[model samples]
Target: MADQTPNSDAYRRGMVTRRSVLGDAHVDRAQANTTSFDAPFQKLITEGAWGTVWSGDQFTKRERSIVTIALLAALGQDEEVAMHVRATVNTGATREDIREALMHVAIYAGVPAANHAIKIAKGVYAEMDQQAAAKDR
Candidate 1:
């Protein structure tokens, strides 16, 4: 019924995009953990979200990352927020951009959600900065 299936170009593109943004280690762990039970769901997200949406030219990866941060914060998805926040390094979204996104979340989503996300962001950013510093040293 659909024009392009997951096994088509979309799947491959999705794999590349997912790996690029999330990094090889994270993607590898996910792939290794994948079983027949959730393979279809993973395929759907890979093909639909990563392949179709992320691979498109409408918005840069940075913009998508910013919006995704806001959505995850609003939804109180702390784990995903942490993961995507880390992906900001590849997506080119700055800490300031993340702060602004959290501000929007406060207004549209809720103050509590934004507050919790702020904590998560701070922790993740600190860890990332520390890692970068270690690399430099």
Candidate 2:
């Protein structure tokens, strides 16, 4: 945490929460790729998304993961949806939870958006399965 830049309480909490949700390897890669151009944007999400909202005690990580995936799907954030779908492993969001969220998306958002996100989720799950299988081998 000391190595993390921006000496703010929010940033510190954000880093911890973000790492817990996204995993150390993903966070490390993101941090490593940080540059002058996107530093501010990165900081904002860390503090706002992770530190403030995500750190709140109101919602469990699993609930948050489901809502996040649905919102990203509605917004057509393909990459974000895929990333969050993968994060479900850490967040304790089961495939059943995600499926229900996408069902909600299909009704409230659009069938096409939910359809695309479902495709993305299936691909991510398959990829995760492959990784797990590799680990067991």
Candidate 3:
């Protein structure tokens, strides 16, 4: 983990960005679950990944979402892939965008990786749909 302080500006900005992308419920759960052993790790991701990379203005959140999903898929990060796929709702990435990204992943990464990521994405979508349905009831 980076030697970044939790009170730093980067951490603060990252918390907002992380919450924006991952939702308050998820963020809150993650924070609640943070242990002393993993606290530094959490700070590193929040300051570096969320603050520096995600907070950059070059790519729209939608573009970042598509790229992140593809990279996570290629790397066989199943859980991260699903999390990012769910985050597409907040990022404004449509299903079509995710489909295209996975197509590229199939070609560039591997069919198996893309296939598994697609499966995860589908599962996340189903859960999201179920949540939406529950809200409507």
The residue ranges of model 1 lying beyond 4 angstroms of the native Cα positions read 1-6
Q: lDDT values of the candidates?
A: 0.92, 0.94, 0.92
RMSD of each: 4.3, 1.9, 2.9
Error of 3 at 30 (Å): 1.0
lDDT of 3 by residue, 1-118 (tens): 3343479888999999999999999988888888879998898999999998999999999999999999999999998998999999899999999999999999999999999998
Model 1, residue 19: distance off in Å is 1.1
- Residue pairs with colliding backbones in model 3 are none
Report the lDDT tens digits of candidate 1 across residue range 1-137.
Answer: 11223566899999899999999999888887877778788889999999999899999999999999999999999999999999998999999999999999999999999999999999999998899999999
For TM-score, the strongest prediction is: 2
Candidate 3's C-alpha runs over 4 A off are 1-5
Each prediction's TM-score versus the true structure:
0.93, 0.96, 0.93
lDDT for model 3 comes to 0.92
Q: After superposition, how far is residue 97 of candidate 3 from its true place, in Å?
A: 0.5
**Which residue window of length 10 is worst by lDDT in model 3?**
1-10
